[model samples]
Target: MMTSIESTPFKRLDAEGRLLKPAHKAETRRPGRFGFRGEIALTIDPPVTLEAAFATAEDGDAGLSFLAGSLSSYKQLPALVEALGAEVKADGKYFIYVSDLDRASRYQINMGGVPLYVLPIDDTSVYNELIDFLYLDKTKMKKFDTAEKLDVIADGAAKYDQAYEAISYEEGLKRL
Candidate 1:
């Protein structure tokens, strides 16, 4: 059952597990299972406020506020969130976990007929930490693009020669 508003480009999906067709970037779409949209690592200026980021996701049409608590169960979450320890507000609330925001953005874009938008707050340290945590052991889950491949290559430089040697000449040439 497609709503009239879902006709918008960002809201379009070919099937249950297919990628949402955004207005731009038609070539980047790839079929994915488990409603895993994708993750974006934000870099901000001064004055960072992650809770505001969560609030933005919450205000999205997908009603992402509901997913906040469940995110505590995601992999790597306990350690990261627990490490926050006493840094959180007196209310003990924050958008420290990226999984919730990522999932919520996916939900809105794929199922709620909403455009994807995330406001980046200022705080490179937190942003860097989020990016690092989001992609931990991520190769086992998602395919990497050229830039990401470069990142992997850079991060795994020690294994580069071995990885290259493991591939046949023809395969290496094809990759090149």
Candidate 2:
């Protein structure tokens, strides 16, 4: 005769015998243009980790969808939103994250039909970081035109690297 060992409720052991906690269900937002939709949790923390930032971009079926720039450039977000007549909802799918709240700022933009979560990093480090993260060849980057470079960066980021914490568009502006 054998007796069954009752495990803790709502908890399970992984292959390595480590206890696994239940996954938290993030709040979902409504669909956006171009069939964009997914869970978007509100995060007050600034994105200090690449994983957090990249997770936002990975939401929905589109995979990685983001653009990055400096705080000065992020200032244009409101005007762009106004031009599009799109309201920035607190729980909206459009999320942005910055490296530093006091200095860095970021935003989101719907270019053509794709929703891009724009991130803000130090202007001085943007190019260097991109080059390193993408493992981009300087000679190739130079040879490529402006549009081509943008494509390369987008493709590379989508493939590799990912952020810290994310906040709403309005919240980001207020911090700025």
Candidate 3:
């Protein structure tokens, strides 16, 4: 025996017991209730990586998701670069590296097309050391000792370049 008018559109009330603005059907949607920004960000793509790896092999640069240690574990190199840039912003422990990527900062060390890798100090020191190897100018054309290692180095290098470009280090840190 109730009319439609009696049914209030406001499903919830305000603190003062007043009718609150009704939510639009669209606004109430939950496309991905558990979605995370970190999970769905623009990252280094694989195809681009393959292409980059072959194209920039001389420089050993590519951006590919890879493991810090085992092949099973993987991480987006771009995200690592972003995190490194953030850390550099918080603490100057690796200011020179971050500054190079930061177009606005001083004391920036332009790689002049050299590859870089800004990864966490993970357990795989070997991997980190290998990446450092790829950064060397002499071995760039040396066909990279290991295929897997080469792929990772290429990815890391790509990230290094990207990270450097995104950040604008505070002026006064550039080296002559």
Candidate 4:
């Protein structure tokens, strides 16, 4: 049986590395096999288009799946923002879905405290993106264990320093 590792709790930080207080609180839920059942409560207003990218592994083998698309691609994005009484600053942010399984992952971009952009990112997408960005060999990476893979992910995440936040699946609906 494959062992599961405890993931770090989600934390929000500012650009200067200072921790930011959570603007919203999430509700707790019962844990599932891989982790909590991945679900979100907040419905995307004027649904945006999404395209599935790839999966990291097969079933029961720590699968990470990805979906990619932009909120700007949606025709209703502006109307949605206007409905929310928010401005379009165009400052994009990344919202990471933090499930212990890592398989159920999605990202979002916020404008003026409103999450207006989102895309799914699976483990395969992350790995592929990292290799291309870092100039790493895919064949060599196939030999990596879980810890090593996590390390590589961390390195890649640090390089961009984008405004990103991680949210647990259990708390996502309430918090978002």
Using all chains and alpha carbons, the TM-scores for the candidates as numbered come to 0.18, 0.36, 0.19, 0.29
Model 3: per-residue Cα lDDT at residue 54: 15
Q: Write the per-residue lDDT of candidate 3 for residues 17-109, one digit (tens) a residue.
A: 222122111111122111000011112343111001110111111211221211111123333344222111211112112212223332222
What's the TM for model 2? 0.36
- In model 3, the Cα lDDT at residue 11 comes to 15
- What are the per-residue Cα lDDT tens digits for candidate 4 across 40-141? 111244333221211111123222211112222333333334432311123322222222223333335453455422333344443465566446667876
Best by lDDT: 2
Residue-by-residue lDDT tens digits, candidate 1, 72-133: 22233333233222222222112333332333221111112222112122333332333353
Candidate 2 or 3, higher TM-score?
A: 2
Candidate 3 runs further than 4 Å off: 1-107, 111-126, 129-145, 159-176
TM-score of 4: 0.29
lDDT: worst 10-residue window of model 1: 51-60
Better of 1 and 4 by TM-score: 4
Q: Where in model 2 is the C-alpha error above 4 Å?
A: 1-75, 84-116, 121-129, 132-135
Better of 2 and 4 by TM-score: 2
lDDT of each: 0.25, 0.37, 0.25, 0.30
- Can you list the residue pairs that collide in candidate 1? none
For 1-176, candidate 2 gives per-residue lDDT tens digits of: 21111211101111222211212212112122111111122221431111221112222322224333322344555443432222222223333334554543334445444354566555445545566646988788888644355456545655753443445556655765
The segments of candidate 1 whose C-alpha lies over 4 angstroms from its true place after superposition are 1-28, 32-122, 125-127, 135-176
For model 4, the local distance difference test gives: 0.30
